[model samples]
Target: MDNAVRNRAWRMRRKPAGLVQQDDLELVTEAVRALAPGEVLLRLVHVSLDPGQQVYMQSTQELPGGTIWPGDVIRAWGVGEVVESRSDRFPVGSHARDHHGVAGVQEYAILPEAALILVDPEAAPLNAHLNILGMPGLTAHAGLSQIGCLQPGETVVVSGASGAVGAAAGQIARIRGCRVVGLAGGPEKCAHLTGELGFDAALDYRSGRLAADLTLACPDGIDVYFDNTGGEILDICLGQMARKGRIVFCGAIAAYGSGDSRGLTNYLRILTHQVRFEAFAYYDYEPHFASALAELAGWMQAGLLKHREDVAVGLENFVPVFHHLFTSGISGKLVLQVRDGVTR
Candidate 1:
């Protein structure tokens, strides 16, 4: 409705040498104008800042060095509402869950239907689309259900247990009647994972002797491991896996920095134990998106599922929030609240 609109978004100010810090980004307001023909203008309500998105910000060997350009609006999957539209198919006031990482970031934006999935916010919480009903949700379902072959009454372990994807994976495994063990950083998060999220067991990696503790806690051995943290913990899983176990490497938050990517020397156990190690990307499971969302929604509606969120107010908090993730101090999905009325 307005010729010019303002948005607050994080922009890269400098290349991060090691761990990225707040000094690397700037939060500035931008103007938003009406769209071209067939374009729809959107106002971001809830933007999901995931661990993979954090890796995108860094210069990495996995991606081969193309980093987020300075001043480019950060890319992410988010939920927004169309306030103005030139496209008839997506009329004004329609809400959508966008697909592309970044095209525009604003209180108002003009976007294409190809980059967004339209939905009614009344159907679920806006943040749900960024969590249990969005990319992370799909990754958890596809990895556990399809790749991990999670069986009922089986023992399962989830590293990075409190993260967006890991949180969803823990609950889904429990719902499948599997005995779930969540490995996090501190006792508080461990308690939350076990008591609040309904996981059967929660282990703190920060405690002395993580590997030994993991061995003691999982005496039955891990039949399935949804690993988000690699490095030492991954090696421990390899050493302690039950015969014919399955492991899913979703993300490696531990190896994100420190400039070294070491391999697990204990991988020979995989051959002896006949364990299967499979790594997958959510992008590869595109078709399963709807099924995963439907199941997650049903669980939520039935009160058999719950999700928590640590919301950072304003886009300015985006850069600092990444530290909370790596430090393992933060709990639940890390969401950037660009504006109010996120749940409403």
Candidate 2:
């Protein structure tokens, strides 16, 4: 290790308005200080990009660990290699991930063992630790199994089905023998969902015929709705829900960028049908993470689950790649590769 290693990071400069503008965050470089006892210095390979990042950029967003503010390192999760370690749990050269802190989105991160999740480099690609075998997959499992009470042969509808969490949710539902329907933005993403990911049907939300199309795709009505995008799509799903249906509210991408979530007018459907509506934060299911990870990893290794990543190289690409989340019709998990050739 070099005596003087420079660390590059993106810091939130101000609370963003509507879409996150380039000026909202500033890139800064400083020397990495020596690690303290029980700490590990990580060379971050890939930073996970999520829609929740948009909410974190706002000053008003309430967070358990507090919100990201001006001059604070933008919060993210990532997988990396321990380059230098002062902890027994994280030896040098071991792979680890920081899913509990704002230490990501930088070329290097110094974190304590308690904040790191030791990962198996041989189980899957290093970036997979940030995707399928990590938060997204875990979120999908928790939402469907714990909250949705998903049963075999049921009808499942996943909005934002091309996204990391939704894609996993749809596939997991399918693995349980459900009739899975996906809603994405474009034709290609829809095709990828049904053709590649084994969804029964996929619809483009941008199309003018969502209501009719959804009815056609799910004639029996949705038994479990894995909602990632809130707003009109949510309202449409609410209207078509079966009696005693379960809704797993995982994200609100439709409203995160603009901070203007549309209120549902069809909420009476909840009362009339005696349906259950539940929203969850990822960490709320931490106690069950180990079992969830094991099951998801097994499915992935057996080819029952598939994952995709739209990765951009360099920490400098962080801002633009994040911007693409709302503007560009990019599919799959979005990631920023801070260090090259660390996929192992």
Candidate 3:
């Protein structure tokens, strides 16, 4: 094991403003110390740039004692290969994915064996581990099956439907025989959701007539609502929900970096309609991960599932590429390819 290896990482420079700026993250280089027992040195290949990163930076939420601060290594989900191993769990040259949140936005990461989930590159493309076969896929399965308790012939509505989690959730619901409707930002994404992803309907939320479009698409009323962008769209869905509907609150990208809350005036409908509103984290359902992964893998192999990735090449381009996540209308999962030729 080489203790002289240099690691380049991106740390939070400061809390973001209205939108994430380049100054919010600073790249730093440090020498990697030798691994301890049960530790493995990982060479990061693909780092997931998720909307949750923005929430972690601004929110006061903390692990146990302290909140995330400037100079702290920005936590992320990534795929890496074990370069040096002191544990049998992760032998050298084996690829693994972060379990909960140990991996960060760095070229090299030293993680304990317990935090690493062994991945098979031969099963699917390496980047798929960061998208459909990763946390987003688990989030979708848990939210739809467990939280939403989705049933066949039910009308399901998913906001931010073209996004990673949202897209997966919609497809999962569709596979379960639900009539899935998606709400995306533009016509292009809406088209992709309906045309490619097999959603029953795709509505452009940016269109002023969200209520009208939703009514037209979901004539049966929404039995389940998978919310990723919680704001006006959520309120609209809440008002149009069927009696005893279920809402799985997965993400609130609409409120991220805005520093302002869009109060849900229609929350009273939860009581009137007897709706069940539940918020879930993917890690909370870890016990069911193996089943979910097997199902998702089978669907992919049988051509029942499809996934897209918007990859941004180069580690140095992390800042601008991260900013592109919010501003640019890039669809699918956003991943940072820190190193190339290793996966392909």
Candidate 1: residue pairs that collide: 5-32, 75-101
Give candidate 3 misplaced runs (Cα > 4 Å).
63-67, 340-344
lDDT digits (tens) for residues 171-205 of candidate 3: 99999999999999888998999999999899999
Q: Taking the tens digit of each residue's C-alpha lDDT, what string does model 2 give over 184-300?
A: 998999999988899999999999899999999999888999999989999999999999999999888888877677799999999999889999988888899889998998999
Clashing pairs in 2: none
Candidate 2 stretches greater than 4 Å from native: 1-3, 340-344
Root-mean-square deviation of Cα positions for candidate 1 versus the true structure, in angstroms: 2.7
Full-model lDDT, candidate 2: 0.87
**Of models 1 and 2, which has the larger TM-score?**
2
Task: Estimate candidate 1's alpha-carbon lDDT, on a 0 to 1 scale.
Answer: 0.79
Rank order by TM-score, top first?
2, 3, 1
lDDT of each: 0.79, 0.87, 0.87
TM-score of each: 0.90, 0.96, 0.96
Off by more than 4 A, model 1: 1-3, 60-67, 103-105, 340-344
